[model samples]
Target chain A: MSSFLVPFLFFSLLVSSVFSDQAAFSSHLLPRPLILEYPENSVETLQTQLRQFDADELTLQCTSWRVAGEANNLNPWKTIPDECLEYVRGYVNGKGYLVDLQRVADEAVAYAKGLQLQGDGKDVWVFDIDETLLSNLPYYKDHGYGAEVFNPVDFDMWVDKATAPALEASLKLYQQLLDMGFKIILLTGRSEAQRAVTEQNLRSAGFQSWDRLILRATEDHGKLAATYKSEKRDEMLEAGYRILGNSGDQWSDLLGWPMSTRSFKLPNPMYYIS
Target chain B: MSSFLVPFLFFSLLVSSVFSDQAAFSSHLLPRPLILEYPENSVETLQTQLRQFDADELTLQCTSWRVAGEANNLNPWKTIPDECLEYVRGYVNGKGYLVDLQRVADEAVAYAKGLQLQGDGKDVWVFDIDETLLSNLPYYKDHGYGAEVFNPVDFDMWVDKATAPALEASLKLYQQLLDMGFKIILLTGRSEAQRAVTEQNLRSAGFQSWDRLILRATEDHGKLAATYKSEKRDEMLEAGYRILGNSGDQWSDLLGWPMSTRSFKLPNPMYYIS
Candidate 1:
């Protein structure tokens, strides 16, 4: 063999061996399923048991229990069951909850930067009022979170006080949005009657210079929260405002047509709304 | 400043400018929402219309329309409404649909490789019949997809003929699994009465050896497809089989406990079963 051909032949031999080894490995590499084990009991029995402790049913049950505290001989915050307490405590006090919001905000900021748009008045951001911008910790702290009934009468009294603190993560995001030249619009399920206190509470909590504040009128109260929120978004679209961003704690606030360009969800496992 | 410090000072200045630029960018970034536009009508009115054309109702409506063809003075296949035909056509004939399946399969194969397990007899893979392993294109070609009614009698006749072609992608994956020493198990929603033809059809479609072929019994006909499939998986777990992988055309076949180590889904927008 020629001297140059010998080196070439040796390289080919090494390459063939490597190729054969890979082929053998792939042929022997049986793929495994992503396995997850079942609970100790049969699924049917477990499902039946699950039906008894339904999350929605328990939450509703607790809501009614708290609402009718004196009527049912229940204590103010004492009636919250042990099971729900852990979840509620974690939401109110957990560092992880705040961290989650911060991470989403960080990603959302990055995404916003990439979009780079001309700031016409039509370029807008929609924010859900209660938990999205302002913290409801004070009320939930005193009244019990999901453990007590949600009383509109008592809640309205709290709302009027206009003292709920700003949700720090959302507040930071709000300032960033304003700097981005996006018009800010606040949409809330709060009644038209509470608009003044809502405005005061928001302004006091460090939210400033929003373009619009929409609240449901007396006639709109009969509508489902999802239906009502969806209609408001539709109404905004009809008015020729392009909702670029929407942040809410509820899925209903985000779903439906003429949706915003993107949505950011803040954690609110404390309660679920239809 | 010393000459040595000049370069370091210049580098620090450059780094600070980049850091400041990022900070300024983040401060002005406004995240957009995931937007979808409405058809011409208002969302509320559209939602109301959707309630009337509910999925179950539409499928049932089309089924009745197809079965009673000619008897009801409707033309064969021509009776299928334009809207339903459009959806069915988009699903089956669309390049996007096939591309989606291929993408999912690639991911599933990668996931399966990572799971690396002993190829013991206990290590098994479960696959749904019909849309997962074999194509019903031959049947659907005549039956008008979901645009026409599904007739069990006619479908059974087609099955007995055993001419349905193998779904090439899934077949390739199946061969790979077998080569890797994983035992293949076929769990189909097809009834036990059709077992003989099902076996013949699978074999003819290039599916070599599988460890088991489970079909629904006559008694299981009353059970919901999901319930029946879940129970069958439970039975396998009880028998000490470790389901490492599952591929199905429907969510029902993949859900319920003792979940496979990994699951691959192939698109089947043709119809939905409860």
Candidate 2:
């Protein structure tokens, strides 16, 4: 009950700020929940604060878990732990995740700036789409903050909406990489059929253009993300592109054969793709 | 300056609980400083608390940086940030570090316990010595908790003392691995010259035996740790031993070819070794 309450509390703040669905589903589209009318010193607020403190106590452990996940220590996890919900919510909605994302973008930008790129336009930066260049938070928040089993149906529904915002930090990195004479190649686990909406979403989210946006083909289904992405990378290598820097939110997007010289992992504690 | 005061404040709490230097450099070995004798609500305590609060505020960013380091995001870092001194100190000394260690050890032990070992006793779990098994915290505390520039001269001198203690969590994992019929291989960046003291230290710290203790040989000088460790792993493969589990606090210990089927990374924010 409190979990529901807290997310609702965070939800109001987020709809106005984080998500890019303002035009599609304006704030008034969802009615105001009656529970939020409670006074400042009410029991509901007290419960939320107490629960937040409990979550705070577990944050060090959660950061450890989250870091372990980032470092690929916790392998093959399907979903984020249920108990880390508040922690994850606080992280994603609060300052932590953004700060982490900013740092990653800074590092990647720094790496890009240092590169002596060949003038041949063959230099390319590979990026994974979901949670890398675009955030699906508007979808995930409704889907347990990735604590529940993945539902491909509504997820596809969310993708079809084509309103996934460009992760601000990644947008900055993308602009910088583009300015530095590097071709942007997005290799994502998203199905090839989603290309139209994906492109629409990318353009709307401020990603003007890319050298290539490669989505998972029908034959690419059933393969591990690492395997699929690796094959794509191999193909890029054959196409005469110098894979300079790779960035992703999952190890599957970065690992496997013929990886780039440097790969930056943006923080993504939500769902594990593989 | 506040920097020196914070370390000193943490110093008192640490000597009693954190370090295992009781016999060699007992609590009495260091004289009581005048400042510590202040009243409970004294200026020192209040200032320390206020500074601690400040450190807590930066912990999320620091955790992000540290996690980025773990995930190989922040590479080639020389030392912990001076600003994150209290944060690192709290993490390393408080329940957070031990809990993280326990979780890693537990995961590795669970993986080891599940393996169907061959009757040949050829399954080996490669372990890094410093920070992976026996900790060098007793020495690191004096050296700015790794915020200060590394002084290899004094560091080697401290290692010569043979007094490092077992990381309790890793020790438990070591014992469990041995019980599960896995050969323990102590492969470390420590020099071959320190074999005697390293052995003594291991025994005193409760690591009784191992299949082999591979250290950096004189001929292996100046090689990058990743290359050197990878070469050692290759040699192990050639020797017909199955590398089942590789555990380390550094990526250099886990990355490169012929890695274990499952490797666990223990956190080490104090320093970066590329």
**Best-fitting candidate, scored by TM-score:** 2
lDDT of 2 by residue, A149-236 (tens): 8889889999999999999999988998888889999999999999999999999999998999999899999999999999999999
Q: Model 2: residues >4 Å from true position, as ranges?
A: A1-55, B1-56
lDDT by residue for model 1 (B88-164), tens? 55435644345445645655566666666775688888999988888887788777776676788998888889888
Q: Report, to 2 decimal places, the DockQ of model 1.
A: 0.02
Residue B91 lDDT in candidate 1: 38
User: What DockQ does each candidate score versus the true complex, computed on alpha carbons?
Assistant: 0.02, 0.17
In Å, residue B220's CA in model 1 sits off its true spot by 36
lDDT accuracy of residue B160 in candidate 1: 83
What is the DockQ score, from 0 to 1, of model 2? 0.17
Tens digits of lDDT, candidate 1, A1-274: 1111222323333333334444443333224220122233334433532442343234333322221221111111333565656445543565434655565566467656666667678888899988889888788877766577677788888898999999898899889988888889988889998898998899999998799999999889988777888898998899988888888876557655556777666655455565
